[model samples]
Target: MGGQQSRQKHVALDDPESKYVIPQNTHKIKGLSRYMSAKADHDRIVATRGWDKHDENMQSMQMLKGLFKNLDPTVMKAVGDIRGDIQLSFKYDFKRQLLLIKVIRCRELPSKDWRSKMSDPYVMVRLLPDTNRQGEKKTRVVQQCNNPTYNEIFAFQLDELELMDMKLLVQVLDKDIISRDDVIGEVIIDMNTFKFKENPVHTAWYMLNKETDLSITGEIDITVAFQMPQSLFVTIHRATGLAARDEGNASDPFVKLTIPGTSVLYQTQVLKKTLNPEWEETFEFPIALEELEDRFIIFHVVDEDVSSSNDSLGQAIVDLKDFDPDRGMHGSYKLADLRNTERIRSKWFQRITAEEFSEALYAHSMSKQPSFIFQNQRTGKRVNCIVSS
Candidate 1:
């Protein structure tokens, strides 16, 4: 346990339930979880939301337990005091087929290190593989040397990192050789890698495939959800790199999935780009519960119009049980990936997705209502509004 030693640990992903979802599914009432007893929030949600049946949903419940349990007791020293929560934000980089991590701090810090004399330390981050995408070859790691403050972050360039599983390991090494007794603050790995957040209006698509036939020979209409604070001129800026905005060459949008639940793979659409800022939006596409009359998915292929910064926009997955009412969506969620697309082994996901999905949604129900939890941007006051789903 050396203070400055580099220890590579397999980040055991605790599939804690999160309430955040896509498009309109994202809306919820804030502070709904607080009415329960300690560790009772998850159970409450399960009992009330039909999530108890799904083990994935249970994980969301377990995650809620872990979050409060993992919190620095000092932060919640007083009885009845609430704990710190995790937030998810996303930015689709069509050019790179990457989702940019955007987290705002309470106060801003300088971009470069030389400007201040604060005890800025080294924050190291690495991607941990999610079991679903475990079939792929190797994993990638990103080491950030001179990050500025607690607000400072370490990001993995998906293209360069090539981490198929997208699991992450984050840490802050007290590079301060002098302060061996470093009362160093924290190492935040926004588990929101799969769940990202953005203020500007954005779009995401969760699509479904036809369950009757397996051959993807016919044309597939991509199901898209456009979530925006306000509407404006929005179009695929080439379905490629956000860095290099081009419109002509891009992939056609297509949906893919796993029956009972589904996960969609957008063409170049995953790396969607837009020129406007100050817009907040989201989009979702649906997929078929069964393709070719079977319950499995390899990967969906959509033609594109241009090459991305890496020529591919990774992949997007969803819950099919949501589409088919009887599938019974459970679990918070447990995601896996592949270096390349293939027919998903039917056995792979049945184990954890239901529990993971259910628990995650229940846990998420508490935090999703930021309109009530966080203070107003201009006037520092907790907002209270009739935020309905």
Candidate 2:
């Protein structure tokens, strides 16, 4: 029995499939005891080798930590701070009503391409809740760099009222030529958290999170008179320094006025071959005085085309917050290019009542003295007389 058991243990050691064979001897048999002693020795050898390997791995990790400490402290600190995020700086100009953003840099970006181990990155910024793509601004792409330095600045025009609901969305994207761009991370900044008056320029590093579902997307000129109780009279007199849309000739321009949230749309006749086109057109809309505060007047200067679609020259937006019904408001407003958000041309305008117009005409016509010839017949005994006509 002892001989058979010894043979079985030797066979189990030789054959890989029989590694789970159990020992059969209960009492001290020389052959079976020798086999058991051999198995314990083999187990002890494996355990000692495993412990030695673990100590060697720990020593290598400690050496790596020492080498990293010898390198740049700033780089190490930044790497530790921004594990997977970006940094942004902000500035607000109350006088100009502009919100400026500076995308400083990005850190610790994940490798989008497994083979190349890097990503072509760019920054996209937009005002939140924008549906028309108007408030979107993008930075130029940086090639093949995980840690990109973009000292790029972007600006957005926002009024005091608009700032209340304004939120800025900053997105870090991986640029792909053939396929759609990949969004790596995003950060949304609430404008209300900033106290612009106290600190005009606020700079801070923000953690990049998941993308937002929100998205977004202009103008005109005229003399606007608000007649007490219910009447808005707009006169589009003329536009000067207008950008020519046609190649050969000057722009064939016209004016379009739109009162937002209402069915009111007014357009003037198109003038041919002129940069400075005069419409002299007056329009009236019945609007309650209370509703004036809630409405914005948009004047679009469009160039008429004979062969193709009409092109927009420029626009101007008018707010009636400071408008006085009795006094009225009138000036030459500089038209804004909504695409670039820059001032382009100026348009002359005036706002006045019907009675005021009649009075001014009467005063102008009566200003000059009337000619009389009672003296010419006697100019032989000439006497000249002035008469009011």
Candidate 3:
């Protein structure tokens, strides 16, 4: 059995450790032993219900633990040990549902060259949880100056909910002529920490910290349908605001869909020289309904490179458990960085949604049961199924 393949042996029911042993009837027994069968049945049901409740409680606790995690001042700090300060102003229009951001200027930015003591500095701005809208802007480079005055204003058409959930990421960089632009520093402002009115603007200065993961900004539209018990259909509709990976401010974009931990990989045809691509192609996966709870569909948008490896522009993941087997699902999803997407399911809103959906499913299952009572013959124990009137 050490080297060669070995088959598992079956256990005999009468063996002491065998789990397949049948329960004693105890119908003729006159003592407490007569309650054995009924007690086992009751205990089994209670164990199942208790385990489910415990699982729900654990999920709730996890949600509570991270409810204010983003609002923490420590978490909103810059990423690294760099030196700089960027001033920004923000205001929200409640009636029009817009967020206005003004990039004021930067000071004390780190120099990016060995030859020159001064560096050309500029600011790139994007909204986090990059909603499939025009949320990116760039300020002009003040050449050979560590301190640059931008005074540029950018607006995002965000609803009240989006404004509340989104964060602003501003990256100061040294624009290069011969090489790729080098980042000077970054400032992340968590929107939850601010209270904005319709007219007044909020302004603040933030220290520029070192760089984090590559900027991920984009959104994709997809449609999902479950074809009963055996097939799952997914449609790659289109993508917008994809990050530019090529020199000409565009990317040869395509979508790759896969289920993690499985060998199933699918792709869409590449659209040349466009930040927005519409494929509207559909693919099918051989999946069963029972597997939905354990499956996640990842839509990875890639930039096709002829001479090099394909670049992952961004990715969006859909939890199969969120699908409605009856109507299915169709929506636009914001693309998240590959490095930051592993914890998407654990986000605060996702947790609340999962709990609500689970509760609704549990209620539906419970509603299908009939209210009735029965007596166990072996133990003369009465069982009741009561429903509230």
Error of 3 at 191 (Å): 5.5
TM-score of 2: 0.39
Tens-digit lDDT track for model 2 on 1-389? 11111100010112212321223222323332344345445545765776554333333333323222222233232222123567788888889988889998998887788889999999999997564356689999999989999999998887767876888888899999999998887777788998888888888887665454331001123577876668787777788887767887478888777665444456788889888887767777668988877776777788899899988776777778777777777767777544212121111111112223333333323321111212234335433432222
Weakest lDDT window of 10 consecutive positions for candidate 2: 4-13
Q: Residues 42-147, candidate 1, lDDT per residue (tens digit)?
A: 4566667666444543454446433333222332221121111212233545466554443322111111224443334343434444433333221121122232
Pick by TM-score: which candidate is best? 2
TM-scores vs. true structure, each candidate: 0.20, 0.39, 0.39
The residue ranges of model 1 lying beyond 4 angstroms of the native Cα positions read 1-90, 102-122, 129-155, 159-164, 173-175, 179-389
Ranked candidates, highest lDDT first: 3, 2, 1
lDDT of each: 0.31, 0.62, 0.67
Model 1 scores worst on lDDT over the 10 consecutive residues at 206-215
lDDT score, candidate 1, position 35: 26
lDDT of 3 by residue, 1-389 (tens): 01322122221112122321223222322222224334445546766775555444334333322222222223222222367799999888788888888999888776787688889988998988787567678989899998889899988887888777888888998889999998888877788787775446888898776565556688999888877667778888899999899998999998877664343567888899999999978777777888877888888899999999998888788888767777888999998664333343233223343344344334433332111212234554433322221
- Candidate 1 structure lDDT: 0.31
RMSD of 1: 23.1
- The candidate with the higher TM-score, 1 or 3, is 3
Please say which candidate is ahead in lDDT: 1 or 2: 2
